[model samples]
Target chain A: MDIEVIKRYLPLFSKAFLLTVKIGWLGIALAFVLGILCAFTLYYKLPVLSTIVRFYVELFRNTPLLVQLFFIYYGLPSIGIRISAQLCGTLGLGLLGGSYMAESIRSGLEAVPAIQSESAKSLGMTKWQAFRYIIAPQAFNISVPGLMANVIFLLKETSVFSAISLMDLMFTAKDLIGLHYNTTESLFLLVLFYVLMLLPVSFAGSLIEKKVRFGMYGD
Target chain B: MEEILKVEHLHKSFENLTVLEDVSLTVNKGEVVVIVGPSGCGKSTFLRCINGLEDIQDGRVILDGQTINPPLQKGDNYRQRIGMVFQSYELFPHKTILGNIMLAPIKVQKRDKNEVRAEAEQLLEKVGLSSKKDNYPRQLSGGQKQRVAIVRALIMHPEILLFDEVTAALDPEMVREVLDVILELAKQQRTMLIVTHEMAFARAIADRIVFMDGGSIIEVSEPERFFTEPRTERAKRFLKTFEY
Candidate 1:
């Protein structure tokens, strides 16, 4: 209700929003790389590494990101393995998001019929060429909707970065509310900043989903 | 006659269940060999083994006097010399008809794009599918997709082509269109190993008929003799079923 309070805290919130976006995107990028690697490992059923990847996926996916963050930030240092809070936040988000992404990508890869790869091989394509040219593109199209969901999910997950002492959007709002008792204004700005971060991703995701559904990748 | 493919002492089994047992056959250059039998006689498995798609328990598939069954690390290069079309057409649903046709030629064979494109167009025209070139696989009928699959294989210019019941998935009406394409290839003396249940078409197109039963070749004879005076009781029984 207090416009003055909101206006006064706008600069701080803006800076925090930028921090949230930067850390969130970096974590998401890391998640994508990890997810693709893990998914391929499982898809190809690579011997020992697949078992480790399966265990990793289950461990991260089944647990809450908050606990993982706590373990990375608080517990690890107790063992003399120190990492900065910012890095801790990004790492935790990425590790958690990677599990979800791996599942999504693995499902996408599985959804492609076996005959596609067989036909590719029948054409004298190396396994790598089949994957790169035939399997990867189709799997990517199938994965878009799921991956977009993961992107938004990972972005929203950045709110918990404040728990690790990173000055993200949520931290700014909670700090302002605690100091000035402007609960309504701080909460309102928190909602607004989160939407600003997530809406474009949602829009872009749907756009991509539409293109994939319509087979835009085809010649 | 010069032999282009030779399958010697092929033994294929799936974990103790025999699928193909000690089956061997030779395909000469410009020969059309059609294998016909009751379902589950290992006809498709034999074709798959020849293309190195399935591992064999005991066998050596020689292509141009080189063993290719336990294919080398550059198996793609060996596989490139043998093209295969599947029963389900298996055209890449994400690619255009033309894209599906030109992909291996450009990517695997590393041929020029424009040249492959031109050959693909000619093949498409030959198959009566030139108009559907830019369309996706899902946009076409089963027969159209099969035609594209054939074109995909033919563009590779493999020494031998394997067709694993390519028309088996088509509607009855669509079957003839696909069969016509294969028959045309036969007229051109393309070396092909086809597995099909279409007895009349098999009789019409096959230079030699290979009759298999329970994973073993019971008969390999000329089409006229195989269809008219089948050598074995199993072949007699199989041909009897087709009698209307």
Candidate 2:
């Protein structure tokens, strides 16, 4: 343990960790809302809105997250809509991940038979009620595992913020290494930090998957 | 007898393929009409069309003088009024049997939960599956699931019930239990339109039998005459194939 190194890096690590948590969860929350609304609009094929969403999905899905971030962070400023690195990173990640999230949710909803909606309708449920009560619940249960995996992927993708100068954990660790040339310790600590951050989400995801499987199909 | 349902000159097509063409039928209140036909004769499509699941190119389905057409959003109450049991059971697998039975009434109809729950338990008892109330659809046999589906429909107190080859997917042993439930429903004299391959069950419970072939109604007659005389050659051939 280098006493000077530990004392010096601790403040940086703490600041970086708080930023990571804030940016990561905010990105996911935004993605989750976009995923739900856009998935539904895609499902119903709402005329021009659906077409725009389809193009958005394709653009985001096909391009790499780093390019999207660069395009947003650097390219946008040239167009006069200057954005902070933190905003660019969070928005880029949220929008990019939202495409995959929409796909996962749409696939889940589709897995429920059209007859389920018909049955609900035949029971006097309006289309909205049928979707909300009958189809959505089943879709959610079926989709949890895929969506959970999407979340974990998105969590890891938050590391791309390092490319822009957002002081996320990755950026902090890299900066520490750059300053002190302590590659092994700095890199290993970053890995440990990521594992600690990500393990809980994956573990909770697996447990939910089990409960959903049991509830959906029974023993 | 008051006519509960009247479908006139119904036409349905999917893309370029015609399913039901100029199909017409009338059902009186408390009457049970069983439709028998070969596979892909548009029997199931007709049932689906009645519930607005299929878009009809032209036709009028008058239930109590209210016309039903595709995109059934306007006549939302028609769903509660006319219940349908599909061949696949279509039970909400995520819900318990009791939940499936009470969902429409309590949630869709916005009825009191305690009252609906009591009625649902009674109906579950009528189906002889009170013990299975808390069980999920996956835990039930095909026959039991179909029976639960029927109870789910019956809970709505529908004016007319449509069965679309409901027993077709069940095993032979499973078929009888479901047929027995239909028989009981017929004995209760709730208006029903049944599409079935079980000629014996159709003959036993139907007030009249409708024979269809190639998307057209070939014959409609009393059960005795339908079983014996069958007016058209197609009906005769259809009955001949069923004899074995």
- In Å, residue B52's CA in model 2 sits off its true spot by 1.9
Candidate No. with top TM-score:
1
i-RMSD per candidate, Å: 2.2, 1.4
**lDDT: worst 10-residue window of model 2 chain B:** B68-77
What is residue B181's positional error in candidate 1, in angstroms?
0.9
| Per-residue C-alpha lDDT of model 1 across residues B1-244, encoded as one tens digit per residue | 9999999999999998999999989999999999999999999999999988899999899999999987755543798899899999888877778888888888887899999999999989998888999888888999988988888989988899999998888899999999999999988989999999998999899999999999999999999999889889999999999888
- How well does chain B match by TM-score in each candidate? 0.97, 0.97
What CAPRI class is candidate 2? medium
Candidate 2 per-residue C-alpha lDDT over B1-244 given as tens digits, one digit per residue, 9 for 90 to 100: 9999999999999999999999999999999999999999999999988988877998888888878774345545777888999899999878889989988998878899999999999999998999999998999999999999999999999999999899999999999999999999888989999999999999999999988888989889999998888788888888888655
Q: Which ten residues in a row have the lowest lDDT in candidate 1 chain B?
A: B69-78
Per residue, candidate 1 scores C-alpha lDDT tens digits across A59-145 of 999999999999999999999999998899889989999999999999999989888898898898888898888888889898888
Runs with alpha carbons beyond 4 Å of true place in candidate 2: A1-8, B70-76
Q: What 10-residue stretch in candidate 2 chain A is worst by lDDT?
A: A1-10
